[model samples]
Target: MAFPRSTCLLLLLASFLLTPLEGHTFNVMDYGAIGNGRTDDSEAFMKAWSDVCKASASPTFLVPGDRRFLINPVVFEGRCRSKKIKFKVDGTITAPSEPSKWKCINKQCHSWISFKHVDGLVISGSGTIDGNAEKWWKQGRVTGARPNALVVARSNNVQLHDLSFKDNPHMHVVFHHCDGVKISHISIDAPEDSPNTDGIHLKETASVIIEHCTIGTGDDCISLVDGSTHIDMRHIKCGPGHGISIGSLGKFGLSETVEYIHVKDAQFTGTTNGVRIKTWQGGRGHARNMIFEKIRSSDSEYPIIIDQFYCDHTECHDKPNAVEIRNISYIDVKGTSKKETAVKIACSDTVPCRDIFIQNINLIYDQSGKQASAYCKNVINGYYHGVVRPNISCLQNDKLP
Candidate 1:
């Protein structure tokens, strides 16, 4: 009843001809130890990187241990793309207090670690990259030229794991114009008082996943800026920072449509706010299909918020910025806060915020709840439960002076 071998040749060939996966393995070595927590091991780190992730070599890179490393931001130029570029750092990479004194990539961004115009690079380590950012952060109060810890730009298929990056003068990690990024099992810590020290800044990216991470800083644990889509975050712990956020968008002539995003199984402690979606009245874009589920918070500000007229600065921008936010659902969110209200929904006038839903949220907003000062148009189908008050008080309760 079956065909003979020669007769079924084409079918057999088809079965054997599935698309093969092209991937490479590389390694890096800091030539640095992990215990001391202070050393300049970047040069050796670069040497280890050069040995492994060469132009024609395998993609995965490993970083071995047993020494001290003081490294500056390694410079990577040109359009570098291969199966994958992996950095296995089992040691420590230390950033100097003065970045200018350290080895720099292009002199534009002072990062302890950086990559530019790369494709499919996976940077992971069971070790630590120490920013030691307190002095720099304190100096930034006067200079205001603080630098980020890790910077990746114009890349794709990026993965970071088993890594601890901390003490950033500015943002701890930044992904710019990079798509397909994944961050897992990473820990970031900075002073809760540091300014602009965001945990992760994902800008102009598509299809990003942040999971199993613990972040504590001064700004948003995750800040999604202009031109991002398909972002998924889960199983995260954040504290003393702005919670996971979407937009202060549409300021730079950008109109992003964020969808298919989910944030769940997250816990927050003593953060300024919990979950927020903020947009300016001047941005022109649409946001749909966002879900926040199974998130818990304690001693937090606004547990849920949607601010369409969001501008923290006075001279905001001169753009036709507006956003259409709809079809957003926040379910199974429980939190205990002493704020005035648990939810705040402030939309824009030209384009309203509608179809926002909240169910099974057990938020405890006391009279001391915080609210946003930014005001805009009214929202439709905006729902809430266990929230005290809104549209009356700005974010004065948690406002820092």
Candidate 2:
């Protein structure tokens, strides 16, 4: 068969164009990352991340299995050339033991592993991130600041799954100022006495989903702070910590808003508090449209609590202003409370909690001799249905002037 030279050249070009481009896989070891658990692998990780960030094709930065790589504080930054990136970690990544060795370049540098300003990022693995944080915990009380184990900040469409975190000095995993984030199949563990080790903390984030996670730590299993909205959490197992809280908001006289949050299908055991919303006294803003449903608790203190005057100090100064909490509902929550008061709604006098609804609550004191109770103050438009302990009549028949 004879063909013109021009026709043949065109055909060749077409074939080349139709071929699929090969994607790059940047291995950490190839970039001089030693997984011996002793050597610092921070530079190697950064080098591999830099390479992948600039790759034209969607690339993967891989940490191989069965090795422990000691990493210092590092940031994986974005505005990357690649539209999608996979951060695969099948091995362990550990922090340094000495707290003084941690470099304090900025507030973001306090995290051991941080992903910032990245879009379409996927962090998935069956591995662990161990913050050797006993020493840091002891030092943090004096220093008044401690590092987080993992943080995803200013990223969109990020997914984190199948990872384990342990012994964080402060918050274990944080999603800060991110949108469209999904976290699932994760496990977080720390000692019950480990100070301020929240399992997962979300702040200034929106459209987030957290599901199928098991978390036990010193602080809240999941904490949604101010500027967080449209969050959904389900199928979570929380214990030995403060169970799933919203706020401590409106702190330092700041105006904070949290809304459209939903939590369901959670179990709490031996927790200090379950499903709580707390706000400082002298602050403004509002928390609204929140729902907690199908929560089961065992020997938990304050299974449901809304403390508008949330002060930890013993000699706290009295303040008039408060965060307006409204349109909150708790449904199908059955539990055994260690404390005599199973439900406490202590709203502020100036800005009362309103439209609070409770249905099908069956909380009882752990001690069979003691009766379950509910305390309410400065709460309005509250509704109750089916088996409310201590009775809603107390609120309905109040004659206070």
Which candidate has the highest lDDT of all? 2
Could you tell me the lDDT of residue 372 within candidate 1?
24
For all predictions, the C-alpha RMSD in Å is 8.5, 3.6
lDDT of 2 at 185: 98
lDDT of 1 by residue, 240-322 (tens): 89888887776555666666678989888888778888877667777778999998988777777788767888776534448
Task: Return the lDDT, model 2, position 161.
Answer: 96
TM-score of 1: 0.79
lDDT for 329 (candidate 1): 80
Model 1 poorest ten-residue lDDT run? 392-401
Top TM-score hit: 2
Candidate 2 lDDT score at position 271: 97
The digit string of per-residue lDDT tens for model 2 on 205-315 reads 999999999999999999999899999999999999999999989888999999999999999999999899999988899999999999998899989999987887787
In candidate 1, clashing pairs total: 35
